[model samples]
Target: MTQAIDRVRQALLQAGHPDTIAMFAEGTHTAAEAAASVGCSIAQIAKSIIFRSGETPILVVASGVNRIDRAKVGAALGRKVERADPAWVEATTGFAVGGVAPVGHLAPALILIDEDLLALDPVWAAAGSPSHAFRTTPADLVRVTGGSVANVKA
Candidate 1:
């Protein structure tokens, strides 16, 4: 496994998560690709989106079928938020934009999970590499990341 994948595995294990990371040769870089690979609905994919509230990084794990409402996010944070550039995302999360996991970020972030994800029993998230992923529940995501569930869907 790559170092990025290893870090994600370690983080999952430390958090007592039961599933192991799965690497796909074809890659899981997009939500559509990930859902197709995993044989699940698009909504079951938890896509981690990164944003910046000034110098602080924010992670929003939203359902793949939904688009995030930046206004709602800003309301929640009580501040304006902007999309993080690729370099900033990598610097803050220790993973590239396409492979940022819900947990195991390099720096602490205010994480917000879409409440819609909670309706799904099983969810998939990126595992620190474009080709890696792991099965998990929304509740597990909240537990591992210490994130709040909100109406993040647009």
Candidate 2:
């Protein structure tokens, strides 16, 4: 495995996940791409969105079918949040835009899980690369990220 993917596997192991990483012959960068690759509903794809809440970085794992509302995010945290740029995202999360995972970030990040994701049994999250992913429950994502569940969807 590549170092990027290896790190994710190690982190999941440390987090007590059941080791469910899967690789695709083709890239699955977008939610639609991932869902098609895994033959699951688009909503089952947990799309990770990182934002700049001032100096703090926040990772919101939301359902693919839902649109993330920045107003809802700001209301939830009592502060406005904007999407982080690619440079900031890579620097803070140690991964590029398309493959940022919910956990194993290079630095500490405040995480938020979409309440809608909890309705799904096996949510697929980007592992470390666009071509890599892992199956997880919404509860597992919450537990691993130590993030709060919120209505982040519009």
In order, candidate lDDTs are 0.89, 0.87
- For residue 1, give model 1's deviation from the true position in Å: 8.1
- Stretches off by above 4 angstroms in model 2 are none
List runs of model 1 lying over 4 Å from the truth: none
Residues 1-154 of candidate 1 have per-residue lDDT tens digits of: 3777888888898989875688877788899989998889999999999999988998999999999999999888788999899999998789998899888888899989999999997999999988899999878988988898888778
Superposition TM-score, candidate 2 onto the true structure: 0.94
Distance from true location, Cα of 74 in model 2, Å: 1.6
Instruction: Estimate TM-scores for all models.
Output: 0.96, 0.94
Model 2: per-residue Cα lDDT at residue 112: 82
